[model samples]
Target: MLPAIVLSVTIARPWREVYEAFWRPEAFPRWASGLSDMALRPDGDSWVGEGPDGAIRVFFTGHNDLGVMDHRVIPDGGAPVHVPLRIIANGEGAEVQLTLFRQPDMDDEMFARDRRWVRKDLATLKALAERG
Candidate 1:
């Protein structure tokens, strides 16, 4: 297990609203640039999307009331990368946090790139959630 990189943002929305916006896999592409064209798999338990390398599959693990949005991203033929996401109450709004784990085999350059991507995605999510 490698150290986790955490990125967070405060959104001007209720915790539940923020969680709901991110709960749906289809909304991922709208905020996460690394993913696109997401669709439910035949099994209906996972989602398939076009990733930077190729097809990517994602499996989410959490409950609606828990505000936990942990998910596993499996790139084409690659091992799963676990991503932990959470939304918490912060004053009149909410704070969203995303944790990106560093893979043992990942180099500093790749890890930095992933960190930048996560930051951008979180910003996008905040903007989207606050737009309402």
Candidate 2:
């Protein structure tokens, strides 16, 4: 297992609406900067996206009621990266948290880059969620 880095942002929106924004695979590219495109597989259990590295497969493992948005990303010919995301109610808005694990082989530079990327993506998500 690798060390996990937790990042969070508070969005001025209900938990349900915030969660719904992330539930749709088609909306990934809009907020997830790393994903250039996303398309659902025929099986419907997973979705494929074009990542910085190449084609990447994603499998979401969470529930709507619990506001858990955890998912696993498998890059082509690479190990799977587990991402734990959650939406928590805060007063009338919601707080979004994402846990990113640093791969065993990742160096400081790469890990820092990943952290920045996640922060940017979270900002985008916040902007979108708050727009409504």
Candidate 3:
């Protein structure tokens, strides 16, 4: 089993506010600037992202399951690591949990670096929720 490091934060914001912002794909570009741009298109029964990641085209899948599937998609070898997170409300503030899975033979340093990115991104999300 892959070990998952769970991180959480509490804010004085209502769950509804955060939930709406997260579900609407149109609002993603404003806060998460990692992607230059993104759009939601139908794929079978899912919404996938086809956007510009600087020079390369980034193809990503969106998960609407279990707490909005609050996550991002980055191309292989493009971004250090892309983790889809589950953002839920814990009392007053929202709780964002990132579950990291160990891909076979993946380098430790790479996972570490990806973990760092995920942390920063989560922090950014928290700040946005507080500000918005």
CA lDDT of each prediction against the hidden true structure = 0.83, 0.83, 0.58
Pick out the ten consecutive residues of candidate 3 with the lowest summed lDDT.
52-61
Taking all chains together, the TM-score of candidate 2 against the true structure is: 0.90
TM-score of each: 0.90, 0.90, 0.62
What C-alpha root-mean-square deviation, in Å, does candidate 3 show against the real structure? Answer: 4.7
lDDT of 2 by residue, 22-128 (tens): 86666667788775555445236888867888988888764568788887888889998888888899999999999989998899999999999999999999998
Name the regions of candidate 3 deviating beyond 4 angstroms. Answer: 1-3, 29-66, 70-84
lDDT of 2: 0.83
lDDT of 3: 0.58
Model 1's TM-score against the true structure: 0.90
Candidate 2 all-Cα RMSD: 1.7
TM-score result, candidate 3: 0.62
